[model samples]
Target: MTTTPAAPVATDDVRLSAREAAERHLRALVGRDDARLREDQWAAIEALAVDHRRALVVQRTGWGKSAVYFVATKLLREAGAGPTVIVSPLLALMRNQIAAAERAGIRAVTINSTNIDQWQPIHDQIHAGEVDVLLVSPERLNNPGFRDEVLPRLAATCGLLVVDEAHCISDWGHDFRPDYRRLRTLLAELPSGIPVLATTATANARVTDDVAEQLGVHADGTSDAAVLVQRGTLDRESLRLGVVQMKTPEQRLAWLADHLAEQPGSGIVYCLTVAATQEVAGYLRDRGLEVAAYSGQTEADERHALEQALVDGRVKALIATSALGMGFDASLGFVINLGAPASPVAYYQQVGRAGRGTDEATVVLLPQIEDRDIWAYFASLGFPREEQVRETLAALAESDRALSTATLETRVELGRNRLESMLKVLDVDGAVQRVQGGWVATGRPWSYDAERYARVAEAREREQQAMLGYLRTTECRMRYLREQLDDPEATDCGRCDNCGGLTISASVSEAAVAEAGQRLSRPGVVLEPRRMWPTALSNLGLDLKGKISAGAEPGRTVARLTDLGHGQALRALFREDTPDGPVPPGLAQAVMDVMKDWSPEWTSRPDVIVVVESATRPTLVRDLADGLSRVMQVPVVGTWAIRDASVPPRAGQSNSAQRVAAVRRRGGLDADVPAGATVLLVDDQVATGWTLTVAATAIRAAGASAVLPLALAAQG
Candidate 1:
């Protein structure tokens, strides 16, 4: 059952001490009559309300960080200060805070991506003194309309400002969100004497120092060295840690199937990738366990439902990616990682989700060898090369009017997602700004800090090495993690598997192993065709723009070489140094299995096979095409040849606009085709799918009735 707050106190009572008022507020917030404020909590509240000074609190999870802010909001509101303005990082965090505030009779409202329709109402509430607290996602601060219309008023009158998860303000934090850096601009614009509070649970000394420095600087660029800092122990006695090293994906899956039922209560099973989350969730359900998959791809409404399910114990677990991390408030009984995150700090943050409100909870790491490769893939997606940054700045500078991200994508070589990430970072760095329609070049002097970025990259490498060391360490697991966070008083915890010996059995029944093996070895994934050409492609001098005609049906990839089952084999075949060779017997066989398991959505087989010409992997592409042709007994049509051999392969490019241009410039399918004949277009791999799209479009326009795109393996 949920907690209910105590009755509201009479705000007009002159005799209520700050301490008395704070205790009352806490009682109301937690629905406890005897709730007492911790000494540090009281100190933070006094600093914000009485002294009106900035403070930083680095406390562990379930540490009542919210109470400090919520109680302070109530006290400040009763004193006739404007509503507290909170800069939060996640929607789940905002939702939890809003609920907690309601219990305390605090009228809290939020404005974020999922509530655009309610933003005006929320603004009115704040303006009319109806809101005791206002919460907003950091990304909202960068929205052109929000920044121009709402921020100035709030900054000028907000009684208190709270930066939750303040560690994100530092690039060194476990998760570096570029949008959070924009908080500096917000801080600079805040009215003088407004109390500011920054709270985080995951920062090491280095990150804390950086965040403190950023928080100390005021609007006029004056630095105050007197900012208060509160540091606390990260040690959680309720957490029992363990590591189960598994040799293969199947072994891990089999182990989970056999052991998950023995876990204490409903909890979270964290996966490193969205695909893995979905895969694990599916396998678990097949094993008759109630579970759900949650990721960024899940709709906002669905994510909320899944979160509620976990909280209410409706499901055994929510198989999730980092999207479900950070702001989730359930007192989960366990947290199991299928693949270890690259950093020990990040690992600590995720595992911290467990044992928060319970006496003890399981925290296990099922580390797999594939995790390193996965980490390397993601780490490579960080800040673009200097040339890409310059190209983006130049494109925006040339535009007189603001250019939308789609239009900018046409002008730059970066993919839309990568391009957007770069622009947001640049926006915070003051090199550019997102304005009314899209983005504009700020024309501010900006230098590419190659040194800083390199340092960050190096830091990431060190973190990865530390995590690997964590797997092998026989010392206290909790101590190893605390030391990674640079905890000053790190010590051995008698709770982990290392300290007490393995409490979890690593054994799995052979039948379970066989089932897991079958599940992992499964191949084939549907490739949903691009519905619309990227926005503003015409501006880049490319005639191709707008919706992709529907005749080029969605295709199939034999496997996402990233899959837990067949991924290892596929990775070996696609390795950089591996010579271009003919399709191997094993991979060729996997393709046959994929054909057998083709989705019902793809109802037709090809009448003619078409190969996408490859300059670098010609032998591999042709051999795969020939192999497929022999298997399906389909006629081999002429290949799509490159118009110019001098154009570089589109292997390294990350953006869709450039990939399309490169593929189109090399124009394929020169000859006309028979009408009404189905064509199976093949490629060695599909990264961005532009190559497949361009080839398929050429085939369809050349009078083929239908086109089915096929590839040996799809890039993860």
Candidate 2:
């Protein structure tokens, strides 16, 4: 039978003082009789528990920021207050916090995206006053049901509110999040004298002031004088930092293969992209080292198991992207960056994961020349243009009912991810509302903050330059990073390479380098055929919907442009300044090899070759098609031409609906195809696959039995 848990009883030790009670809770939390709170930790706890005031604590990792809140929760509950609500940022962090609360004898529960089924039961427990502490994600703050139903009551009844990773709350911070801005509304709803705590290890002077200002404001938009700011020096005594520069990516991989095991205990190897994580992990595994790849693409269950594996020292390192940045706690003995982060602030956050539980942790960076390109790609995804925002608002204003993101895709020119992000910002800004089905206009006046966005963009550019400065600086590495974070006590650490403490070897075995090069050079990526047409295509005057009737066969690409192997070559060949000509001999050779490997998987041989007309690189596309036809002994059939030669093809079209419409309006097969013949459809590159799909469909209508698509590169 199901039963609700009973509410926690207050501590019976009334004779003990508040400090004594906090000490007792601390000892219980750390499972050590000798455990005691630091001075700043006690100050933070006192501000919340004794003074009933808002506080922001900025301390280094492993400085016991969590102990203050957990201890404060114990004291507050003992004084007959309600449960403490913690707005945490990451799932991994939530799990760790819940476990820590359990250690302190506090009954904690969580509600996040991964636990939808348990939200109601958890809410029941909260209503029953059985939960002493409740953890929630920042995204949950604006959830329609929770915001309308649960949040108001939780705000009124909650005794304490904690915002962990508070750096994300400020736009000036390296990891700015739009959802976190909703905390202002929550704060405005909070009753006076309800103690609140904000904590982060990575807030600079600017971010610190921003967060403190937010915390000090009350329900009536008035500032309180009693807000406490407890900030400590940012330093890690256990970290020994160094930089190892290599001439090429292959040398870096080779060096890792040669020296990864020589580092301290289990750790992480950070990569700039998901593709790099996979490639690095595979290479390291092939070299007889136990490793696994972790990214946003990794499954939740698999990610949990991988975390466990790392904590248990089963894997030497987790080759990962920024997805593993926050809230993952382990006694990591080392951290190696395969490429530099865009800013020193972000770099400091990632490296903070290490040296938290142990002394003498090794930190290294292998700076790459390609880091700037990766940074630029991410920078492009920032806030949209003023015109785009206006277009979105106009569309919502014209709609009678709430429109889903898919429906908006037909009317707006933004991609799905970018569009959803903009709507969230709009919702938080009071210009729109996210309801049961979708979003609706709130009719509230909203203006584009052009100057603010421009400032943000300029700040990002400065941060990028600062990261580049870190690479070339000859000063103390640790101190350099600390200064970038605006640490007042930034000083030289005696353990970095510049300080003459340690020197990393730049040597790699020639054989290992050769092997690494060969592994990266071997390339063939399978492209799955598009099975279904994009939704609401009919709205664009295209008579297409549901599953495509005659789609192109599953195809092959020589490599993804994101690949570490053939990517460099393909990027050079596709540059705007590079003159269009015959395909490079080296790339042509690689394409032939890809065909050789893919031939065994084919259901039938191709009898004719058809090339997709390219306005940008026509010479390269035609030369590739003719070379393939001559080598494979297939007849050159015809060209797939753009029906309108006067109109230039649009570049950087955002969504699939727009891309499909554009392709169908201009795509046509200009050559005759033999009936019941297999046709090879070739293109220079495949981004959305709409052009190839349209061309293949046209060929099928022209009496071809089957169409096999091929591309030189795939854009991920």
Candidate 3:
């Protein structure tokens, strides 16, 4: 949507000083006659509008970072400059910014993943000077067509460049993004005299300096005049920071159910995982709270609707992951984290969402022991090893044509998400180029930068340690966080728990605890069978292609390994130090519950049970099959053995193609199958589902009419 055009610059307005004009614009933007620009905000706006200087603003959230750019855009456009180009990070932020721009009578339009059809028209408007501000995602910066075509003209003509969440440009930032690093190329292409503004509330001193350096580089690869770095105190006086130590996931849920209604207004309840969001939101809703789950997995339309719901007070809270971290604007009364973030800087950013437009808001952290495990899981998705990177580059170099990510997956052992992330970094480093079809090697020399990656990893570990320290800290929470961000003006915030300005009850009602316990302990997760084989399996010496002719029927698992309830138990049972043994009685009962819940959907019970040999937990797999066989009154059949014991375990394989190839290479089903008999296949756990799929294909090939796959836990 476009904003209202600016009112004509009157003869009298033309004579007004820049500061006076900025104050007038601020009054219009805030829709208050008395509204005035804060000194820092005005300074930032003037730097860009009057001085044509690059600036980085690292003030706290809700500090009017958007106002600096929008006001500057108005001043620039009114003086015959082209529209400002804002490389925003999220659609929610774009929506908020567009509305804010409209308030200032600055026309704004956006091009993001949500509006592919409108991109051309939006670009047309941009070129025609009909749009006063253009907001695009950082990913769009490297689009084949946009980067090769539209960006040059935009860079040459754009009056101002704005990078929201500028911390993402540095690897040291808590929310580092490889796509943001592409801004270096964009900055290099811009003509001289164009002003740039990078804004983020989450950056620490290191990130601030790195972003400033990146912002100051000239088109000639030389450092230009120092960038104007405007950082302010990060303390939020309106926030009442506190921490409630939770011994169990159930207690955390109960605490939320017990006190959510007491919170002043609708806010956010942040979880570390998408599964947790659904779990927590469901439990809260069942307890009569109006809440919904939000994450990257949520559809675009639903995310928008849920955001509006929270804004309109339709929902008490939106249980979410980091997907809701940036650009979500609500005068939230509380923000509760069910688990702690790995970094205090990231934690500060999420908590910043609260108390933005309110006089006072509650910010609480309910730290769990499992948070470290969750942190480790996320850290594992970072840049792949040097060997994996080299393999990816070699694959691209040898290919005659550009290889799609799916195709490349068969050639290298990196998951799709990690592979795509690496490709973006490579593209930014000039070692690869993304064209119309996919990605191709540019034949540019590239180094792995092992030392740099090690430093990043070390920094991450230190941040994680600091987060743990936050959990144990007895000092003022706000002051501790501000100090972590290197805020020179940090002082004890008397509004936190330690300072006695706020007191939160740690007790949860017995009834709520019992109900929460029941919800978390509930078992059973649907395991949808794989229908299609991975593409280009031949690259890995596999003969598979297209849809599988012999696939297992839909099955059931006791629970996802990531589930807050059974997940915790499963994690304990499957720890690396945990000894292999027969299935525990409790877990066996849960498996039975899963079966009972799933029985209604099955056409018939299986005739026989078979076990997929587990190299890691052979005894556990066999015992699970034997127990199921006795319970279901189905005879225990022969085992499906791994043909070659020396073959490497499937755990080491990263991508789907590699896992499939590894499973197929070890021959399947060793025993004869009764023709037309249904077979029950049991495994300890299912991560990629490839092993089960390959084994089921073998069972079906042995003339079984149907194969039913069962696993104790499914990886989320």
Query: Which residue segments of model 2 deviate by more than 4 Å?
Result: 1-16, 645-652
For each candidate in turn, the TM-score is 0.96, 0.96, 0.97
In angstroms, the error of model 2 at 316 is 0.6
lDDT of prediction 3: 0.89
Error of 1 at 223 (Å): 0.5
Give the TM-score (vs. native) of candidate 3: 0.97
Clashing pairs in 1: 414-655, 415-655
Q: What are the RMSDs of all candidates, in order?
A: 5.0, 4.8, 4.2
- How far out, in Å, is residue 564 in model 2? 1.3
Model 1 scores a C-alpha lDDT of: 0.86
- Candidate 1 off by > 4 Å: 1-16, 599-604, 670-672
Count clashing residue pairs in model 2.
Answer: 0
Q: Which tens-of-lDDT digit does each residue in 353-407 have in candidate 2?
A: 8998897898999988778878988898888899889988998899999988887
Tally clashes: model 1: 2
- Residues 376-476, model 1: lDDT tens digits: 99998888899989989998899899998877777777777788888999998889999888899999998999999999999999999999999999999
